[model samples]
Target: MALLIEWKSGGNRFMERCNGALEAEILACVEGIALALHWTMLPFEVETDWLTLTQMLQSREKDLSASAHLVREIRRLIDGDREISARKIHHAQNQYY
Candidate 1:
């Protein structure tokens, strides 16, 4: 899967960068977690280090069409079986309001 970023940086920031290796690794981890959770009928949470990637996967961004495809695959695997969500945290990036 790919990564997506959504940020509100004091309404001044217009630049962004993503760590390709980290994103790929996170996506793989999410996929593995989903597969592991599939055995149980009970719903569970799927957490990731990259919250923006989660949101974008759920929202399915158009500009990042390539990434969207991978997200769609993950969504399909988890479809109707569980609920998935995204959460962002304060990292090196500017604090979001």
Candidate 2:
């Protein structure tokens, strides 16, 4: 599943069932980011709930974990431009009943 939310404009949402582990689904979501946003929309920042992703993106050394390729791809996109930035932010807690 992929989600895109713009401040002023409306957002887009997508859902796709994947036959793999959670890591694989995470990779799918990360990969979809590039396609979700436009190239000309550089100098933009993405606030994420996942602190690990934020750390991975900001890290200089490549992450060689199971999601290495996924992280590497995201790093490539971040490196492709100069003004792009990503940071970890607290997300609202969800209650699972």
Candidate 3:
């Protein structure tokens, strides 16, 4: 399973490029995506519009660790596929960053 980390800013029109929701919800979305993929490596990719989510995953904090662990579990499940990568893809032409 591939993990996609997304950051949704709380209902800020100026920050429209980001999702307007709590971090947990965004993380849940990532988990859901992983489950959908059945923890398969198979060249999977995760994408998020915000850079913060990506950076958070790299942090050493306990909270961050849990989230990262969830993602890692998915990776381990699909160990053989070994083609996972995450990147930011432009939402819509008019969408924010």
Best by TM-score: 2
Clashing pairs in 1: none
lDDT score for residue 7 of model 3: 34
Question: Pick by lDDT: which candidate is best?
Answer: 2
Which residue runs of candidate 1 sit more than 4 Å off their true CA positions?
A: 1-19, 60-63, 88-97
Candidate closer to the true structure by TM-score (higher is better), 1 or 2 = 2
For residues 1-97, could you state the per-residue lDDT of candidate 2 as single tens digits? 2233433223344646443554553564465466545544535666566777778778898587777777777777666544666776666631122
- Model 3 sits at a Cα RMSD from the real structure of 8.8
| Cα RMSD for predicted model 1 | 11.4
Alpha carbon lDDT of each predicted model: 0.53, 0.59, 0.48
* TM-score of each model, in listed order: 0.51, 0.60, 0.41
- Backbone clash pairs for candidate 3 read 1-39, 1-40, 8-19, 17-96
lDDT of 1 by residue, 1-97 (tens): 3232232323332325434754573556455556555555555555555766656655744636446555666676667735545455445643447
Model 1 residue 46 distance off true place after TM-score fit, in angstroms: 1.1
Give me candidate 3's TM-score against the actual structure: 0.41
The candidate with the higher lDDT, 1 or 3, is 1
- By the TM-score metric, which is better: model 1 or model 3? 1
